[model samples]
Target: MRLFSLLLCGALLTGCASPPPDDPGGTWINQAAIDAARESGRLREALLAYGPNLEWQIHPERQQASYSNGFELVEGRLQAVGAGQWQVTFYGDYEEQLRLQGDQLTQVASGYWPEQRFARAPTRGDEQAPLGSSFEQALYRDYLGGDWLIEEGQGQGGLVRFIDNGQVQGLPGAERFALCLAGDCAAMSGEHDSLWLQAGDQGSPWLFVHEGNRLRIFEAHNRAQFDEMPEYQPGPQRWLLKRR
Candidate 1:
């Protein structure tokens, strides 16, 4: 009788033993998109390629996941393969590996691009804050160092090669590219992501809006003139470019 009781107790204990639950599962956003440290390195290249508008939702049940940024959005079914190792399978048989550590989550996009980092939101509200100027500067350093296309230049799409950090770009007359303020070219881009970049001959700086995969460079004569504008939309002539 005692042996039977011991065996029953052991069986019950074994049945109750289960793996730990998903601790990082919940709404998460880009860390750099928040009030991050004044460090350009924090705005990771992989994350930037994902786009500034990033939103992720990991279900508490640990079985479903969803990712959305400015460029793409998809939902997937997730399964834990090992400790701190999980895989998400999207529609059409696409799969992505994921690694979760505490409040930070790293996702490998489509098993191609480098893994991008994300942080759990402090609250369920999921508030979004404007990005800083440094984030824009960081883009050229790593994200935009490769070749890009001038969406519509000289009546057709032209090639624009960013040799390194937009400084030595191969853009016809605008040989030297730099983002600065219109009033004072050397002034800091305070509390804003869109800064003025010179397109050379305009005798003025162009308003450069940093959008992942695409860029909108609007001609702004001066700070006072651009400030009066209410919205930012499509620009005319040699103002748009897309990643190639």
Candidate 2:
């Protein structure tokens, strides 16, 4: 019958060329390349010690995969393989190829191994920073370098200025770093939306514990998940700030 109808049309084109099944669930953060490296300034305080508050956490119905600097994804599955491309396959076997662009999700590794990007995390209020939280490494080596008055009390105060390049300023209406306004302080220099720095590019990465000079601020989840190698105590939420 004409070679069995050409072998049943080559087995229906090899079952429609297989490959395409792996959804993987929840958690992911690159916040569009951390908001495009905090808006072009190329924000890089060592990538804020890889702590932008938990990034990546697939589940695939329990196939497991976790990472926020702790690394766990012993096995993986992301496999989209088309339009925006994707292919994951974790540590056990190791494979990569993820690209998205719009919301950013890169990870096209091969040899040098660095790519990695991600996003899509804020589903609700978004707050998860407590796994050995050094508060983004003590806000990038001690309260984000320079200029801070913040004494909001009797004399009522505000004059932040942290600027290692990411830029930030306060003084004018200052509704607590309201994207800078005191006469256009560069319109919130490289926005990261600081509530105490929430992911590089500067300011409000939260969680502090200085001590001698006082600096205890913690509320972004109530802080208490130690493991990044110990040495960090001060959890009661006093919101004390002093580093002029």
Candidate 3:
């Protein structure tokens, strides 16, 4: 009787240890997998969705959407709710549903209409293209996204903004400034000659360094060479910019 009881207890424990059944709608996809697919050029279709203080990049190629603020979609399902309309349900920390029609996608919870639009997936070459030097490009990718205010210096020391359209603006009184990345230079007016006129294919005159939430800007003939100079110190060149 004692041996039989022990065997029964063992069987109960084994059942308890088993994982729950997978969701029938879809399988869980992680960020690493999504990034891998994007890097390898396997992403066939993409969607960009915006909400209040949130953004989501959806890849239909993998049936996954990367959400902002760590609100990710582990698994998702698309069901036809009506003609020319489909309901997209994403399973994550909590379940979220969005309405989709053609290229437009809307979030049901927020009632944010026309929240999503189709976009092309960025290729590996697009990701690797240098905005400045390798270091500046790394910093730019990680920290340069929104508006920034230059705290100190002359002329250009006020509002320096970085836009998603690959443009930089708010330089003192100048409202618009184009960004020259690597070998590519977007057309700029002759008015910009007062500032650095000749931008090299390798780097920019305005060098950016990030420390915590603040970004520092420095002016140098060659930012890459300035970085290697023994006298170069981030503290002295005070054009500190704070994100707005």
Candidate 4:
């Protein structure tokens, strides 16, 4: 029966088809911010700060999520109410309603929150550096976390502030941390006086050493590079932003 065989084959193929990658099970990156950085001509700074190389993991099965820029982890009750739809309640009466459209997950703007987009990560966290210690984490939160005005002639003049709430640029899904949080400060050779910090995972990390009335900024890729050339020739002649 040719018709019977055709029907059976169709059923078999349907049963064996792989699931879509849209499920909220893997990693996501702040692509919207990345695009903004590229447009603003701060692609390198954006990549280091926002970490285009980094990833944010979402475990739908465990109802857990981890941000790559080393904020705190979020655990909540994730419920699938419909296809491509999920609601995560992290705290009392606080909800993070999500919508998955192909590669982008949008936290639909609700109440005072605005819409934020996160693109699926190209790779996982296996290839990246780790976030620093609990003690170091506290220091970073207190020391480096502040409202900063990206001074003119520095990099690109703008408001680069790290808020108490887990949002960068008034959007969700980003946090700031010490770029050298893994206890590698001493490795800065003699440039040890400076504090290196990273925000989002997009912008490049900047070194801040308290110099007189302002926190002088030195731009670099990461801590490992800084360790190799502490007396980095370019030296403290750029980025005069203050941590207000």
Using TM-score, give the best candidate's number.
4
Structural similarity to truth (TM-score) of each candidate: 0.40, 0.26, 0.29, 0.43
Candidate 1: stretches off by over 4 Å:
1-22, 33-53, 126-244
Q: Can you list the residue pairs that collide in candidate 1?
A: none
Which residue window of length 10 is worst by lDDT in model 2? 1-10
Model 4 residue 244 CA deviation (Å) reads: 34
Query: Which pairs clash in model 2?
Result: 30-118, 196-204, 196-205, 196-206, 197-203, 197-204, 197-205
Off by over 4 Å in 4: 1-22, 42-56, 66-70, 127-244
Ranking by lDDT: 1, 4, 2, 3
Q: Residue 98's C-alpha lDDT in candidate 3? A: 50
Which candidate do you rate higher for lDDT, 2 or 3? Answer: 2
The order by descending TM-score is 4, 1, 3, 2
Could you tell me the lDDT of residue 131 within candidate 4?
26
lDDT of 1: 0.51
| Candidate 2 TM-score, C-alpha based | 0.26
Best by lDDT: 1
Clashing pairs in 3: none
Model 4 vs. true fold: TM: 0.43
In the range 25-90, model 1's lDDT, one tens digit per residue, is 656666554333223323333334443336567664759977765335578898888788788888
